[model samples]
Target: MKKTLLALLCAFITSAASAQSVSTVVHPEWSKNAAIYEANIRQYSPEGSFKKFEEYLPELKKMGVGVIWIMPINPIGKVNRKGTLGSYYAVADYTAVNPEFGTPEDFHHLVNAIHAQGMKVIIDWVANHTAWDHPWAKTHPEYYIHDAKGNFVPPVPDWADVIKLDYGNAQLRSEMINALKYWISNYDLDGFRCDVAAMVPTDFWNDARTQLDQIKPVFMLAEATERDLQEHAFDMTYGWQFKDVWGDIAKGKKNAADLVAYLHGEEAGYNPNSYRMLHTSNHDLNSWEGTEFDRLGDAVETFLVLSNTLKGMPLLYQGQEAGNTKALDFFERDPIIWKDHPYRALYTKLFHLKQTNHALWNGLAGGQPQLIKTADDDHIFAFSRSKDNDQIIGIFNLSDKARKFSSNDPILQGSFTDPLTGQSGQSASAPIELKAWEYRLLVK
Candidate 1:
C-alpha cells in the first residue's frame, strides 16, 4: 500500500490546474447502477482474436452484466520484457493497438458489439507509468521522474521494467489527460479501469475524471479501497479489505464476527454516492495467487453469492464461471483449459436475480443489509433487506457443518420461495436449514 511518488506529485499539479481545468459540467447517472465484468483477452479463447471474442457479448448480456472492463489492448513494450509476452501494463504506445490482439478496427468492432449487446466497455488504463520503450521516454525526457542518481526509474521497487511518469510537469498531466480523452472520443469507451490506481495521485484521477466527462459519460473505477478516493472522485473502488476478510475466514484465521465489522467499517469510509466493487477473482488472483480453489476453497460458492447479493457492484473474472483451476501465467501466453461445472449455473441465477430485484439494486437504490440474530453467530452470517413489500434475505453457513438460525427482523417479511433452491426458505414461524458452505437467497 506504499504511495507511489508520482501519486503525491500529481496532487500538487491538480491544485494548480484546478483554476484552469474545466469544472464539473458533464456527468452521467447510469454507471452508478452498473455491474462490472473483467475480460481477459489473451486467454479468452485458443485464438483470442477480437472478432471471436465479440461473439461472447450475447452470452454476457444474458448473464445481466452491464459493464465490460477489458484488460489493456495497447501495444506492449518489448524492452525488459517479462516472458514470451510482457505485462500488458507495460505500454509502448498509449494510442496504438497491440497487433497480437488485432488492429484498431477489430477492437472497434468488439466495442460496437458490446454496445449492441447493451453493455459498455472500459479499457484498463495505466496512467502512472509507461513501458521503457515508450516514445515519450525519448521525445520528452523531462516527462519522467529521476532517481537519486538522476536516472529515470520505475515507480515501485519491483516494477523495474517500466518508467514512471512525472506529474510535476503540468504539460505531462495534460498529455495523460489527452490520452484518456482520446480513447473516449475515438471508440466511445464508457471509461477506464485504472491499474494500481492508488499508486497514482488522487488529484490526477479527479482531474482526469473531469476532462473525460467532457468527452462522454464516464464511470471511473480505482484499484483501491480508501474512502478519501471515493468522496469526490471515482464512482467505484476495489473492496480489497472485504476480499482479505473472506481470505482470512477461509484460512481459519477469522470468523463471521470479523465479517460484520468489515462491512460496517467500510460503509463508514465510503461516501453516500460512491460504491465498492466486490469480486471473487481477477487477473491478480489468477496470476499471482492460485485459483479460487487455492484461495477460498469450499467457501468459494458461499462467498461468491455474498459478493453478488451484498452491497456495491459484483464482478466475475473470465474463467471463474467455468471453475478454472489453473494459475494463469501473468507474463506468458497461458490459456485457460475450460471445463463445464455447476459454477456457471449458480452464478447465472444470481446475476439475473440481481438485475430484476429492486431490493438488490446498486447504491442507495438498494436496501441496507441488517444482520439477522442467530444462535450460531460465529459461523452463520444472515442478513435481510426490505423496500416496501419487496424483500431480499440471505442466510449462509460459513462453517464446516449445518447451522440452524432465526431472526425477528421483518426484512424477512412474507413467505416466499428461495431463488437458489426453488423451495421454501425460512418463514416467520420456522427457522432455516443450511448445509456446510451453503447459501440461500430468499425473495418475497
Candidate 2:
C-alpha cells in the first residue's frame, strides 16, 4: 500500500512538472528586456480616437517604450451608467470597439502602427465582470451570479455599473475564452491585462492562457499580485506592496532600512523568475487614490529611479511624462495636458538605461541586486547589480535633509559613468554628498 501511494505521488509530480514546462515555454521571446506603458485611451487626447493616438506612437518609441498596454477598448454599457462618459471597466461587448474610440478598422490601424514602431500592444481585458447591459445577462442569465431574489447583481456594491460573471458554469467559461480568442484572431492583439484577476478562478486563467498561446505566444499581465498567478497564467503581477512602501517612505513613516528589509522578504518569498511590474503611479492609483504628486510628494523623482532601476519591469502611465498634476476623472472625459517637461527626459534616459544595462533587465535576464553597506544605512539606500562585467551601483538619500554617505564596499568603489549626466570619473574615496531625495546611478 505504501509503495502504491508513493508511485501515485511520483506520477502526479511528473505530470505537474510537465505542465509547468509547457507554460514556461510559452513566454514570448520579445518580452525579455521589455518595459510597459499604460495608455489611457479615453484621456490620451481631447479627441481620444485611435487614429489620433496612432500619431503619438513614434514619440513613445523614441522614449524607448517597448510595450503599450491600451486601456479597455470595448463599448461601455449605458444601463445605470455613472457619468456623462462611463467608466471603461464596464465592458458591454468583448469583441466590439467602443464607438467613442473608433471603428474596428481604426484600432487595427493603431495596432499596426504600434507594431510598425517596434512596440507591442496589449489590451486591457475585464474578464471577471461585464456591464449590466451585456447581452449575456439577459439572454443567458445562468452565466451570471444572482441574489436571493434571483435578480442579477453587481460584483460589489460600489461597482454598480457592472455585473459579475459566473465562471462556475462551463459554458460561460468557454464563451469568455472564445471572446478572448476573438481579439487574437481578429486584431492580432499580443495579450491582455486582466482586471481584478485574483477574483476569477485560477483554473480559468490557466485554461485561457493555454488556449491563447495556441493562437500566438502572448504576454499576460494580472492586475493582482498573487504569486500563484505566475505559476502558469501571467508573466507579470502588480508590485503593489512595493508601491505602498514608496508611499510610506515619502510620508516619513518608513526609511531605507525598511526598504532593505522589504527587498529581502520579497526575494525569499516570490519565485526568482517571476516578473513584478514596478511603478510609482498607475491608472487605479491615479484615479481612485491620487496622482503621484499627491501621494509621493517630494520623493516622486527619487521613487521613479527606484522603479526603473530595480529588479523588475517598470511602468509609465499616460501623462506621467508631462508631469500630470491632476487625478484623472474616473467617470468623465478629462484630457491630459501635454507640454515639454524634464520628467520626459528623465524617463527617456531611464528607459534607455533599462534596455542596455543587463543588470537592470527584467526577471532572470538581469542580475539580482545585492545591498551594499554605506555610512548611513538607515537613511541611505545603496545597492549594486552586476551581470558579467556590466555593473551598476545605485545610492539614494531617502531623507528630508541633505546627508553625506560613505561606503568602502569594493562593488561600489570603481570607475563609472553617469547615465543621467554623461559625466565619467573614478570614485574619490570621499563621503558622497547628496541633497534630500537625490539619487546617483553609476554604471561601468
Best by lDDT: 2
What lDDT is obtained when candidate 2 is compared to the true structure?
A: 0.88
| Candidate 1 lDDT tens digits, 281-355 | 999977888888889988998899999888778999998888988988888777877788788888778877777
**Candidate 2 residue spans exceeding 4 A from truth:** 1-26
Minimum summed lDDT over a 10-residue window in model 2 is located at 17-26
TM-score of 1: 0.91
TM-score of each: 0.91, 0.93
Pairs of residues at least 3 apart in sequence or in different chains that clash in candidate 1: 7-201
- Residues 337-415 of candidate 2: C-alpha lDDT, one tens digit per residue: 9999899999999998888888888777788889887879889998888886688888899988898879887776667
Clashes per candidate, residues 3 or more apart or on different chains: 1, 0
Task: Candidate 2: count the clashes.
Answer: 0
Off by over 4 Å in 1: 1-27, 424-429
With candidate 2 superimposed using the best TM-score fit, by how many Å does residue 2's alpha carbon deviate from the native? 48
Q: Cα RMSD to native, each candidate?
A: 7.5, 7.0
